[model samples]
Target: MEDESGIFARESAYLERYVQLGIASGRVISVSFPAAPEDDAEPDHPLLERVVAYLEGERDDFEDVTVALTVPTAHRTVLEATRAIPYGEQVSVERLARTAGLDADSDDDRNVVRDALASNPAPLLIPDHRVRDGPSAAPPEVEQRLRSLEGL
Candidate 1:
């Protein structure tokens, strides 16, 4: 039987989103990202629900199943920080979530990462952690270089 680990998987398309755009003088800004398609493939990942239920002490049907998530290279600092810690001492998941502006404490985030590790998802396990951190961490010279290369 294939260990569920080390397989590539796509991010869940069922996750919800909220965005706003166009606010003047403290009114607000509204933004429209693409809508998740209704016909998108359903999530087979139950880890999020299971983790929540476990944390809440409401889960009576506990069976081990893995879930997967994708970590984009755009958030590399989190990955590097995570990698710095030995697995036994690693607190990368929470740190990564915080760096990515996601709720690190959320079961959803945790499960997503766990799943990704199990499945060996791309980008999540790729060697591009530097890209993950945002612009503030970029040095002035590097930033100038990146900008110079942008339209080329």
Candidate 2:
């Protein structure tokens, strides 16, 4: 795992990716990065493969993956808009509010988008990294990794 410079590089293996994705009713519910290593075998899910590939620097929109919104109805609307953010692109929370048909000028409207991203259950699938401002979808390190992978 050491680079030519002799510094250890972060691994992106399927298991080492260590992104915990939760699902129910055949839909993704949550995605999180834990400090501990995964214990059990990798779950038998096609999206897991795609996610691994994405972590390895592949470009995947993940738009085809279905996710169940755990947020409120209005917040779900913001998440719905979040899903439209293209791969390798970044948008501010205010722009996301406007995309969700919320008044960008209203702090309340922007807050809704912020809150939705903050509580985003399915981070990678929802591509919360594509959204800037307010809360982040993944941890600071993971978020930077994702951005680097996307060349953002």
Candidate 3:
């Protein structure tokens, strides 16, 4: 298992539009597009620069980003499977469950996967958006841009 820390720091940027990065315990906790700026706004940092580069398709810098999330044990499998999804690709919940060694056919197990994805704390870093049935925390345009970058 990887130590879920020191991967990225919380940073904000106006890449394409205003976005917020939430990091803690040395790992990214969330990525969101805020409608307004918060009071403690800081200037763009290296992490944001890397994220911008990634979104622009200039580089795959975000691939190295790590995230820290504290969900129930059952959700861990779902998150782990989500993390393994390659950039520019999508997979169904059943496929994800199977990849995570869970019983894909079980309604209860599938629900766990779906719920975990819906509640994903880290979006871009863990990339729950890559899951076909997962909720996307990022703006639809941003998600579309990412997919376009991959020619998906």
Candidate 4:
């Protein structure tokens, strides 16, 4: 877990929405602060709570949460396989491609995995940091931090 005093979130009305996570320094990717909290009793704020909990060191798999991913078919396949990566575990891009039903030994297949992760719409939800042997949605430092947090 990391210190969450700087934590912030932008919630969505839809139950499942894409989120970009940057855990290092607690900088919420593409987030904005209102300078003052709103008083609205929005019922769809569970994502905020779950993200806060995850930052606070909870071992949340996040499988319970859904996301609306709109990507190319190849990217979608790779991202969905990435999403199935269990907490504290990792796999190579070739392996991930294989899991996604692509030929594991094909360079093109592996590149697709890399490109898909680079464009991942839901970082934390997809856990792209777990892709050990290729490009990740997380920045280098952020990826290291996330892996450390997962006890890898």
Compute each candidate's TM-score over C-alphas. 0.23, 0.84, 0.79, 0.71
List, residue by residue over 42-83, the lDDT tens digit for candidate 4. Answer: 323445678656756888888865555678999999988998
Lowest lDDT 10-mer window, candidate 2? 1-10
* Candidate 2 local Cα displacement, residue 37, angstroms: 5.1
Q: List per-prediction Cα lDDT, in the order shown.
A: 0.31, 0.74, 0.68, 0.67
Q: Model 2 compared with the native: what TM-score? A: 0.84
Steric clash count of candidate 1: 20
The parts of candidate 2 lying over 4 Å away from their true place are: 1-17, 37-44
Residue clash pairs of candidate 3: 6-26
Which of candidates 1 and 4 reaches a greater TM-score? 4
RMSD to the hidden true structure, all candidates: 18.3, 8.6, 4.1, 9.6
Clashes of each: 20, 0, 1, 0
Top candidate when judged by TM-score against the true structure:
2
What does the lDDT read for residue 46 in candidate 3? Answer: 66
Q: Model 1 misses residue 125 by how many Å?
A: 6.2
In model 3, what is the error at residue 46, expressed in angstroms?
1.6
What's the true lDDT of residue 9 in model 1? 18
Largest lDDT belongs to which candidate?
A: 2
Q: Which stretches of candidate 3 lie over 4 Å from their true place?
A: 1-16, 139-141
Candidate 4, after superposition: displacement of residue 121 in Å? 0.6
> lDDT tens string, model 3, 28-126?
777676655456655455667767666656646266666667889878788888888887789988998898788999998888888888777766667
